[model samples]
Target: MSKIRVAVFGCGAIAQRRHIPEYASNPNVELVAFADPNKQRAEEVAAEYGGKAYENYEDILKNEKLDAVSVCTPNYLHAPMTIAAANAGLHVLVEKPMAVTAEEGEQMIEAAAKNNVYLMVGHNQRLMPPHVKAKEILESGRLGRVLTFRTSFGHPGPEGWSLDGRDSWFFRKDEALMGAMGDLGVHKSDFIRYLLNDEVVEVAGFIGTIHKEDTDVDDNATCIVRMKSGAIGTLMASWTHYKGGDNGTVLWCENGVVKIGTGQGDEVIVELTNGTVETYKVGAMATNEKQVPSGVIDDFVQSIITKTPPTISGEEGLRSLKVILGAFESQDTGSIVKL
Candidate 1:
């Protein structure tokens, strides 16, 4: 394919902020179509990006001659849309929390494999500059094995970012599945796994809707995760951080402590046990106020063009989702859930 013809399945906040713009900017991608339930939103995106507007996503899958699609729809729609696109012989780059249930994630993966297409999940935390640097440091064996860690991703809420404002589907249980945990927790879970190169084997947490009104889903969650290597850490997600956002991770290792995304300008800070301090000035983390290229779109497009599996594959997404699900089970049962 000369230029991978791409269509966006949702014209909402994530599509506008990340997917469409990145695809348009990518020299290897030709963004060809946009689909959304809201016709006007789709039309506006198409007008800006030079594509056809589609009100129904099925129409795009049926009519468009596309090589790939970014499934940027709500959480509930991710599995079905990706399965459909894969069945149509198109590669899929789906948003985080790949599906509502593990079964759905498995089905999406099966569809992609059966159709012989790439299925990438948008777990963009691993693409952040600070996170990339931190991973490198850990791999060097300088940190000597992480003992304990804490990673958090929080903001005021999706209301400030979602196109639907306070009434966004992010707060709906049916559409979003889980609120703060699904939106923010999964990112941290995936990040922790990437940083440690280990799976989260056990999860115990307290997840609830503490502050948000008129929402059945949780507004805050605090999970204690134990990795396969016996490293324990805390993973927190909050939509009620009214003051400001915190996307920071701190890993206390045998040799030193590595801090990521905690500094104002410096993105990574390392404090050694032998009284040495090192800092890195990687770029800022993407936030609602300031959007940056997440690198997910480029990775997905390149994987399709090169006929290779994406960095964040469907199985990786499913693993991250399983962590969040285990946390939910722990919350419900008041006992540690084993993954």
Candidate 2:
């Protein structure tokens, strides 16, 4: 079997810690090139993966031989990079918050379609075993039509991951857009939507900067969602939580509740209507290490090979982005916004 030739833009933490490592270990992919504005960073990461470095992403796109490219840039760069890669006839696995705005996301979707290329969003939560199990149980009606859902995803500030620390592009309105909602809110919105198989029809929400002093963007946000299925839900995302509990999602259905964490070695807990509760530890359930996988990239590779829709396609990313954007609109106008 021939390996898929791939290039990666943005040699940042997510790319270093997850993307590169995952692709490095996958025999089906050939890591061909790396691109980042910072030459040294790109060179270091590329050296580890046995790839060449390009100071400009265009250099990689100019290569006619690559089959796919991973867009791992900041939130703002997602759309333009993905569209460019697609136009270059390369499949794209873009990082989450597909774009800062829904319009941009649509452009990405259109570009992928026009180019006849695969476009997948890197929402790795969908690949977690507990989350996978939750999707299965929820779909099987063991949860009995998710009536209400409340989920939150938060962490300490992006000091470790973001390049600029507290003054990172993440805190800049022009580069990061709406802060907490875009960074964490959208992820939860997407995860819940995938697990419950429902769309948010309306949202009444608020965004604020409860912490992270001197920053213009919101560090905390909460929103109430009206799902298309007539179910109600609430979501919170923040960087203000001092202790940093990490990401967590909870679904309340007619029968019971299910909860999962965003960290490694975590388990999924279930509570049934009869008051019988069970906690299915991920490692115990899967007979493998309980950690996030580069399954998103693996799935993207398969989608490109088989001409199939990725589990988290660009269109799916747009829908999830809509909820978060709607939340911002709701907060600004003090009114419920329809999807």
Candidate 3:
């Protein structure tokens, strides 16, 4: 089997920690190029990760002969870069917050389809072992129908994660777009949407910059959602968990409540209404301090090689982003926004 020629369009934290490393480790992938505005950083990664560095993504799309590319840039650049790569006939695996707007995401989807290339969003939560287990339990319907749920994804902010620290693009509104909502909440939106196999039909949310000092975007946010299955849920994202982080979900069903990422040492704990309890060891969520290799890059490469659609397709990203976009609208309008 021939290796898939691949390139990374950003050389930052996500690229370094997940995409580049994972791609390098994938036997089917031949890491060929790296692109970044900072030529030096790109060169540094290229030297270690086995790729030629280019300062501009356009250069890579225009010149390289590659089968796939990973768009790991800031939230704002996701759609444009992915569209360009697709138009150039390269498959894409882009990071979350697919685009600033669903319309932009649509353009990306259209480009990928028009060019007959695959577009996969990096909704890595779908690949989390605990989340996979949760999906299985929910599908069993052992707890009956899901009635309500609550999920949270937060950290100390991206400062520690980014190489630039406090000076990272995450603190800049124009670059990062929104804060915790985009950085963290979007992940919950994707995961929750997947777990329930339902779409959020309406959203009522509160977004704020209450905690972070001098930040133009919100550092904290919470949204109440009504899903198509008639399930009502609360989704929250924050950067102000000064004490620690709460990245987990709790589902309340007619027969029981299933908790994923809640208990210590037990990532998944399911409690039935009958008073029976169960604990699952599906592995822990990836943390900044102790990160795990994600399956995103490998899946993207395999989808291209197998001529199959990616699980987290461009459409999936657009659909999940709709809930987040609606939440922003609801926050601004002080009322519920229907999808």
For every model shown, the clashing-pair count is: 0, 0, 0
Supply the TM-score for candidate 2. 0.93
The TM-score obtained by model 3 is 0.98
| lDDT, candidates in the order shown | 0.93, 0.82, 0.90
Task: List where candidate 3 sits over 4 angstroms from the true fold.
Answer: none
Q: Cα deviation in Å at residue 88, candidate 3?
A: 0.6
Ranking by lDDT: 1, 3, 2
Tens digit of per-residue lDDT, candidate 1, span 1-339: 489999999999999999999998999989899999999999999888898999998999888899999999899999999999999999999999999899999999999999999999999999988889999999999889999999999999998999999999998889998999999999999999988999999999899999899989999999999999999999999999988689999999999999998877337999999999999988877888888889999888888777889979999999999999999999999999999
Query: lDDT tens string, model 3, 6-56?
Result: 999989999999998898888888999999999999999988977799999
Worst 10 residues of 3 by lDDT: 261-270
Off by over 4 Å in 2: 262-265, 284-291
Query: Lowest summed-lDDT stretch of 10 residues in model 1?
Result: 259-268
- List, residue by residue over 179-214, the lDDT tens digit for candidate 2: 878777888899888887888999998888876876
